[model samples]
Target: MKPSDPEFQEFAEAANLPLLRTARLLTGDWHLGQDLLQVTLTKVYLRWSQADRWDSPTGYARTVMVNTYCTWHRRRWRHELPRERLPDRAGERDTADTVATTDALARALADLPRRQRAAVVLRYYDDLSVEQAARALQCPPGTVMSLTFRALARLRQSADLHDTAVEGR
Candidate 1:
């Protein structure tokens, strides 16, 4: 089916939620995820007719999402504000621990270099093959592997530090 066809729209709509979830996992903010998704959808729309011919539509969307995210990171400086300072909803009090853990993970993710973060997100979160992620990132597969290894190491170190702090407290 052509990208402009109704079936294409249906497929895009059906994939939206999962795409947003993956975006949020990669970006660590709902607003950023929405923005990323919007950008991705716009790119998909522009290339819709061609996208339908690809072997994997979801992979195409993911590559768009990653490219858009990388562009945003490169062109903009996203200010890092402490999560604790943000206003909380009454309902969220019940899920405070979950929120805290997510916040910790997000902070750790933010600490990584952009390419490393992208490698980690694409390889692990999106479950893309190294070759696929390399294509998406316009890098060699060896580079993707290196970035993934470094990112995982950094995340592990940060997690261990967080655990130690909690235990000390």
Candidate 2:
């Protein structure tokens, strides 16, 4: 709450890695994800005083990231292409199967509409309940359920997921 609060700094430090990962998942590009994380963190910092009242401020920051990403998606230049993989090379020990499976999942996730992707990420990746995700999305819980259902259905129908075994949730 206070500008001098060290607790917010600790929260930010603890939340950064997960927030970065979530942003990457949301944007499907590392650079865009980093931008999203920066925007979200700036907003979170501005609201630092009120964040202490929330059940989990980290979760609030995630919600901000989702909102910011959605905004970016809506206004992004049409020419901006999402990358299927990060530029970083894997270590020599990494297997092809692992890389392929990861790419497939990323492609499937990337294909989703912004809202559906947000719902899927919030529900599955972030492990939020439908109600919690609904709050994050500024929608009713039923809408969150419907979005998640459709997102999962689409993911299941994706060529990669269907081509792979991908069983058991």
Model 2, span 1-169: residue lDDT tens: 3444587788888999999988888887777788899999999988888875777897789888888887774443337667788768867695767667777888899899999999998999889899989888889999999999999999989998666544413
RMSD (CA, angstroms), candidate 2: 4.6
Assess candidate 2 and give its TM-score to the true structure.
0.80
Per-model CA lDDT versus the true structure: 0.80, 0.84
TM-score of each: 0.78, 0.80
Q: Estimate the TM-score for candidate 1.
A: 0.78
Distance from true location, Cα of 39 in model 1, Å: 0.9
Can you write out model 1's per-residue Cα lDDT over 1-169, one digit (the tens) per residue?
Answer: 4555676688789999989987887677777788889889888877887975787787788888888887784333467755757565567348766656767788898888878998988888778899999987888999999999999889888974487458547
Which portions of model 1 show Cα errors greater than 4 Å?
Answer: 73-94, 159-161
